[model samples]
Target: MRIGVLGTGGMAAALGGAWARAGHEVFVGGRDGAAAEALARRIGGAGHGTPARAAEYGEVALLAVPAGAAPALAEEHAAALAGRTVVDCTNPLAPGPDGVMLTTRAGESVAGRIQAAAPGAHVVKAFNLVHASVWDLPAGAFGETPPAVPFCADDAHAAERVAGLITAMGWSPMPAGGLDRAVYVEATAAFVIGVWWAGGSPRLAFPEPAHPSA
Candidate 1:
């Protein structure tokens, strides 16, 4: 798959590296072209001038920028993203006295906003519940083995594609449901954040389901 990643952050770099390692063609784009190029070099992928260029280069695009920046990025790359599958990997986190706060409403989410802005694009929510660090860990980085990462999307094909990509990175993929299910996914992210803060470790991941007895 020719994948494009918009955002020069840790999450973007992590996913880009995973895809590149999985033998997928990946192009990374950011506000700083140089930084994006550097990341691509580190990740063994390609880099682009802007978000639009990255979107244009990819059959599928991953929007891994800040939740606040998601809508603007979608609008800026609307032309490029038209008729393409877009995987959303952002969390609407707001600064608060205690900790980060979720900025999305009960009915709305960042993925929904991106879909609304780029109506022609197939926007799917994913990668919002895990930390970037988890993506780089070796297989069995956790205890006995690695666990599945849960994600959701409205578009079944897009969801399957992203889920396959996730599995290629040496982790299992658990599909939670459609786009509206993003609310639960984002809330789970907040819960994960709390658990990390309390435990002081980011290496932990959610456990996968056990097989049922016959």
Candidate 2:
């Protein structure tokens, strides 16, 4: 599988490196050509160039840029992204008067906005739950059981393909629902971020929700 990474930041390096180790071809791209080239070398990528070129170079494109910048980036590469699969790992968490909150507009997630920006691209929301450092750890660093990655995509084929990439990177893909549900996914990220800020374990609050079996 060929993957295009659209950022030179930590998240891009971590996930891109993992895929490269999994034997997938990775092409890293960024505004800073030097940084992109360096990351590609570090990850043993197939090549490096501008984001537009990377968008056109891969079967899957990973948008790991800041949430605030994603829409513009997506719009800029809309032509290259058409008929392509886009994996969104951006979280729009920002400080609020109350606590950690999603920076997105009501009912609009970063992924959703990206989809709107590049209407022809099949956008899938994923890889937003954990810190970039988590991806840097060796597989099974958490334990014998692999971690679960909850993702959402309206396109079934795109979901299946992204799930394959997620699996290749050593995670269990938990398909939450369609792109319509991505707002909730982004909320979950905010919730987990709040938990971490409070020094609580977010993992303890997942799956098998508490309810009376009546």
Best by TM-score: 2
Query: What does candidate 1's lDDT look like per residue over 17-49, in tens digits?
Result: 888888899888888989888888888746556
| Top model number, lDDT | 2
For model 1, what is the alpha-carbon lDDT of residue 130?
Answer: 77
TM-score of each: 0.88, 0.94
Q: Candidate 2: which stretches are off by over 4 Å?
A: 207-214
Runs in model 1 deviating more than 4 A are 143-145, 200-214
| CA-only RMSD, every prediction | 2.9, 1.9
Candidate 2: how large is its RMSD?
Answer: 1.9
Candidate 1 minimal-lDDT segment of 10 residues? 200-209
